[model samples]
Target: MMATAVVLDPAVTMRTPEWLFLSTGIRAVDHAVEDICSVTGNVFSEGASMQALRLLSRGLLGAKARPEDPAPRLDCLTGAWMSMVGSQSGVEKGASHGIGHALGGTAGMPHGYTSCVMLPVVLRYNQPVNAAQQAMVSEALGQPGTPAADLVAGLVAELGLPGRLRDCGVKREQLDMIAEAAMHDRWIPTNPRPLDLAGVRALLEEAW
Candidate 1:
């Protein structure tokens, strides 16, 4: 969604409230994943990304606690829109999205489920390069001082979403192919740290 928005209008800039209300559901999930691994130096974009995650966490939790309430639903939608606010036309997504595309395109995994399983592992793998950002992510998700990966995994579990690649029917044998494909994904170049086949494979192994 952010990718499409960037392509359609590179000059686009979301308003503050607009961003807070825009990110939700799977779109919020995508934003959170992308921000964690992004190398872009834009502070506003990074801050918005973290806020999107925080909003998403609140929205999801509210929705879970009161399924009949419409407020949480609206919050989620707003969060989704905000999540994509700073995405630029030429900027690529990071490893979670890149790997997710490979998994979805090659392995036929559902997009949301792909994120559910891969995001935590991607965060953990990229932590060395982006520990501060990851810490922000953890705080946004309401888990200060905890490993971002575990906090993310906990969120997935709380949402009753798949938390492991194997749980989503991803076979161990397919990791190599997925890793190879991820290495070539456009998003790989924009990852916070360099990504090689070996590193990609290691991330995949952890996801598996």
Candidate 2:
């Protein structure tokens, strides 16, 4: 059942540890990136996705630079909410979200951490097909001309979050299983860049 209304309060989120907050904030960043780059995306979702990136990047970095302040988390919340708007509009996410699910299911990784590692890898893999769209993502993240993948990795690094599969303790042997599982995810087919099983495996290897 869908809720008729939703409410968000940044005050209630302060109790969460800083590291965890930063990790999930990256997941919100991943959402915006995926929404803007999805094969079926439109201008309405692109607008919201760009705004989400703007707010998340500023707010997440602000929190990293000033952990003593609680104000930036409100920006994060608003940005995350904007991401939900794009998602709810049926703008499908791509291989990043798909591979992230495989990591969660096959290796017990959190969606946030998986996003940190996989979003960059997936963006790089898709870049050849979607460079123009990705340029917009990098610009929204405050770094035009930088690869969107590098910008995301840099943002994750600034937050002191883990940025690799090794950092999350996933073993190399698991890459094959994760890749196989990722192929079955609904979002994989919707990726802006077409991905067969080999492409999925290549992405996992890069992340690993």
Candidate 3:
């Protein structure tokens, strides 16, 4: 019998990337985590998000940026919830992640690369949720007044990332499974709106 081997890299290997992320400020990380949690029903809150960002920024941005003033404990919980909402919106709007995930394994791409590619599409898909948020997103991207989806689409294009799952090597037969997996994921619960398998399938199909 042949045995498969598992290997783990030392913790030090992660130090650099972690530091880099911290350097970028915790608010960014909070955004990433919250986006993941929001759509997926993951545990997160905006206040907690602020706390983590504060702690991380203290090191990266400076001690002055640290969260010296503490928020109420419940604020952390609310932040956590907000984080989930943010994460869900990220995934739901573009459907680009599905492509990125498929491409990651097939093309040896990194997680950030995929996310950069897909964020716009997800924002576009969820445009109906709220125009204010969409407008804010556009402003953040430096393309104010642009529709959120279009703004993101432009960003994705500028990044030179693949826009389709088929281009990334996903098969038609796999769509059903991927859609099912996404809908049932823990993050699904945190999504601003409930998503069904069919909705997930449609997103996948659109991406393809």
Better of 1 and 3 by TM-score: 1
The TM-score leader among the candidates is 2
Question: What's the candidate order when arranged by decreasing TM-score?
Answer: 2, 1, 3
Instruction: Please write out the lDDT profile of model 1 over residues 122-159, one tens digit for every residue.
Output: 77778888888787777777788999888777777777
lDDT of 2 at 138: 89
Model 1 per-residue lDDT at 156 = 74
RMSD to the hidden true structure, all candidates: 6.7, 1.2, 10.9
CA error at residue 135 for candidate 2, angstroms: 1.0
Give the clash count for each candidate: 13, 0, 30
- Higher-scoring candidate on TM-score, 1 or 2: 2
lDDT of 3 by residue, 59-105 (tens): 33232233232332223223323333434433342244444454455
Worst 10-residue lDDT window for candidate 3 reads 69-78
